[model samples]
Target: MSHDILRRHLRDLIDAYNFAQWLKTLKGLIPNEFICKRWTSEPNGFIITPIDQIPGLNT
Candidate 1:
């Protein structure tokens, strides 16, 4: 892809990643019951809960 196109795609990816991180943070601020079930979904660079799990947190 051309540099301009690559840069635009990267910018969009970054925006999406940033939005996901913001959503995660927003979820943390809200009550568990009120939060969306999808809050646990992974962001590009954000790790909410690990695959191996953190014992009580993931359980």
Candidate 2:
């Protein structure tokens, strides 16, 4: 495998292994876990409406 592929794979695997070993050390968002991360990366222009704006969610 190419160096780039090996590097990325190794990074993700290492982070996963470390996170599992010390899960209690993580109190916030988990590393390599991406959702807002995806939204931040793409090229788009949609106002990130606050979750509080959802009429039913607040109810």
Candidate 3:
């Protein structure tokens, strides 16, 4: 999705995906796992972990 489209639809998308709370909870997580395993092949970088893995995700 385009940045503009993503920006405009963020709220709707979050609600539709049932990820609003997940996103909020993940905000504090540490980067332990890769968001995508293949992401490691990229020159840039990527990271992922369970939302509950975050320091305060359960709060």
Candidate 4:
């Protein structure tokens, strides 16, 4: 019903849901994909900005 209550219920089933294991499996799929990208917005974090705004990234 509420955010906290929903999160608490999900937390109890973390193992049953295999959340961490599912993430690990997804991580392994990254390399299998043909096209992979790591575009960055600013110095610290990764966010996608318009090409015109981050023209420095243009190659």
Model 4, span 1-59: residue lDDT tens: 99999999888788657866665766744422311222332424435333345435566
Q: Which stretches in model 1 have alpha-carbon errors above 4 Å?
A: 28-59
lDDT of 1 by residue, 1-59 (tens): 89999999999999999888876877745334233334455334435533343346645
TM-scores, each model vs. reference = 0.46, 0.38, 0.20, 0.25
**lDDT, residue 3, model 2:** 100
Q: Where does candidate 4 have its weakest 10-residue lDDT segment?
A: 32-41
lDDT of 2 by residue, 1-59 (tens): 99999999999999988877665554445543333444467626437633333346555
Per-residue error for 31 in candidate 4, Å, reads 36
The C-alpha local distance difference test score for the whole of candidate 1 amounts to 0.59
Off by over 4 Å in 4: 15-59
**Per-model CA lDDT versus the true structure:** 0.59, 0.59, 0.54, 0.52
Candidate 1, clashing residue pairs?
none
Q: How many residue pairs clash in each candidate?
A: 0, 0, 1, 0
**What's model 3's lDDT at 19?**
63
- Sliding window of 10 residues with minimal summed lDDT for model 3: 29-38
